[model samples]
Target: MDWQEISGNWVLIPPRPSAIVHFLGGAFVATAPQLTYRWLLEELAGQGYAVVATPFVNTLDHVAIARDVLNKFENALDRLYATKTLRKAYFPIYGIGHSMGCKLHLLIGSLFDVERAGNILISFNNYAARDAIPIVEQISPVFNVEFTPSPQETNRLVQEHYQIRRNLLVKFADDNIDQSILLAKLLQPRFPGMVAIQTMAGNHQTPLGQDVSWPVGQVFTPLDAIGQWVKQQVYRELNQLKREILRWLNPLS
Candidate 1:
């Protein structure tokens, strides 16, 4: 399906959508999520979901970023409803995020009064500004800066606030930078049996990538064969992630 821009968000709406998925991508590729996360988002759309992917430029103040994206997402929903693109009847809404996007979703869920059926956090990473953006330390040694809520403060907020009952934390097998386990510990207590953790294959960058067309040469070469194999692996990983998310999204029925 072709994506449309509404309220500064890229949206892919199917003819009949069972639910809506509000997606936020990782910091580096978030600016153009429609292109960077096209494969994953479109897969969700293909599975009867109206995908609303919001793009945001990353800054040190993650709280502000979260608030802004939430506002934009809500506004887009409003427009969709007003235009009759989305039915006025009750429909489930879920939040899905990758990498830094996961932290934004967490902050939004904790700080706002928005209603979400559940949240799917993939490769969650909450790093200090110095570590997330190494150039910040190299450029200025005099000032000490960090994310607005800070890593520790974010955890405190989640522990004290996060109201969402259903949460799915997805951690990749080879992702060294992932911190979903720590997040699960913080959230599991607040929600008890509602929190679930699922381990998947692939690394931090698994959620980012689009299909590339590998042109055939006059004669089939090993390099060409290797390219085809790599493409298959990428699609395999992406499809696996999609299946896991769809399974959690429809656990009961």
Candidate 2:
């Protein structure tokens, strides 16, 4: 299905969607999530989900970014309901985020009054400006630039204010910058048994499925066989990721 823009967010809704997923991508690629996360979001839409991927420019004020995206997502939902694109019947909403996006979702859940069935936080990263951005690192000492909430302040807020109970913290095996473990530690205490963590095999960029399709010829050559094998391996990890997400999203199923 083709993606449609609703209230400044990229949306893909199938007929009679079972759930709504509010998605946020990583720091840089968030500006074009429709292109960057096309494969994963389209897969979710195919699985009977109304995917609303909100694109935001990375800023130091994560709190403000969270509020802005939340507002846009709500507006898009309202339009979908009003236009009869989605049924009037209740559909559970879930927040899914990657890298820096995870921190924004956490802030929204902590500071706003939004309801979510649960949140699937993948590769949650809350790093200081110096560490996260190289240019910022070079100029920070001279210009004094830093995130508004700061990494420490963000943690404090999550520890003291985050309200959502059910959470699935996904950590990647080879992601050096991932901080899902720390997030899980903070959230587990607040909600106890409600917080669960899953470690996957791929790295941080696993969600960004670069699905390159190569055509096969009638006279299959060695290069064709190698290309096909590579394509299968690339999609295998993505398919596994999708299955795990679906399992967590619908545990009873």
Candidate 3:
């Protein structure tokens, strides 16, 4: 669990990893990826995957974001190879994204010649900036930022060009913001039986992180037991989600 800077990007690498994982978090989350996706990345690290969590303030121009994603991932690999940090510079690279991150991966797949094994799209949402970002609808008239791919354009692009062969779309049962079903519909025409859609009992933020501490000020409350039960359910769902993700990514295994 060490952090290093590569080509001006902060990355966390685990010791002696077998493969690589490129992670992208949801929209407007500019916090360090290492912190925002701490639980997911740490678990992946423990599973022997070198995870490179790229931090970026998600903007309207998703195509631009996708380009930057490629740059960071390629640059990281190049640096590792140049320094002889890993025996092999390139390994099976998997794309892992939550929410808006899924759109970027889909864009990457549409573009030709990216070395990606597969992708896991969790709680996918491709809402317009005005809709996705609260109060942006009110403020956009004053300061407009016409985000590229505009949700409609994202579909147009995917319909015109999508080269991904394997995809795993996971949607949580309680996630009302999820568009995984819609995404699966779009990808099914292109990838056919290649897309695997899995439904689990959790919400959009289930895999991100958890707070397990019980409320200490109160001796006990009726909701306290319910809260504990819900927390346990979250942990269980997350573990199952991880297992399904790994299973889909590692087909031969």
Candidate 4:
């Protein structure tokens, strides 16, 4: 997957205070299908954020495949930062992901030295599918990164921080709801303050595409509604990110 700027019907927000916000999309869908995501990117740009959404092939399932894709993303970020096409310096960098995209973010965030990254935002992270052993095994060789339990590692390595935010957002009405909760609990000990899971109504794939309006007492939720909700969340997060960038640029004020 080549890292490219998001194009087509999307608005661009100039970088504020030298910060860049990149949105990563999930599996089995092209980046274009994520209309709500597009809106979010535009909103972020409107708020003085230089937003870029990178497209990747969603064919791979294994953590190793995902990591390879993430490497491309990391390299693209480096190129973008080096060109300094968006803004000045001392700006914050952030990665935003949804669904499988969230998993990819976790893998990259944990393995890569994204310390310069201001923060990571993840939505609907279903950790049940990810094989921890394979993920750790694949990632360990890349960085010579062994799992040595330390204070900082304990905090940021797992999705602990994410859990705090999750308790507020979660609305469990489905069977797989436990998957999200369990993943957060499992990661708490290792990455005490890393993962943040925000809950929205619907199953794993509900928020990906368009939202639908179902009749009352219907068996399933409307896809259109879920899609709209996802889009709304994306817009809100991007807008906040833009504000953060603007603040970073004018720190003294």
lDDT, each prediction: 0.92, 0.92, 0.80, 0.47
User: Could you tell me the lDDT of residue 193 within candidate 1?
Assistant: 96
Candidate 4 residues lying further than 4 Å off, grouped into runs, are 1-18, 30-36, 81-83, 116-178, 191-197, 200-253
Report residue 13 deviation for candidate 4 (angstroms): 4.3
Candidate 1 positional error at 109, Å: 0.9
Report the C-alpha lDDT of model 4 over 1-253, residue by residue, as the tens digit: 1123522212244635345665666555534533645544554566665665656665435356446655655565566557764433565656555555555555565565454353343343443222323565666556644322222343354444322221111222442533456556655455446444454344444334342343334544587567667667644534443444344334464
lDDT score, candidate 2, position 41: 91
lDDT of 1 by residue, 1-253 (tens): 7999999999999989999999999989999899999988988898899999999999989999999999999999999999999989888999999999999999998999989999999999998888899788875467777789999999999999997889999999999999999999999989989999999788899888677899979999999999999889877877789899999999774
Question: Which model, 1 or 4, shows the larger TM-score?
Answer: 1
Q: Every model's Cα RMSD, please?
A: 2.4, 1.3, 4.0, 10.4
Error of 1 at 18 (Å): 0.5
Per TM-score, the best of the predicted structures is 2
What is the clash tally of candidate 1? 0
TM-scores, all models, native as reference: 0.93, 0.96, 0.86, 0.52
Models sorted by TM-score, best on top:
2, 1, 3, 4
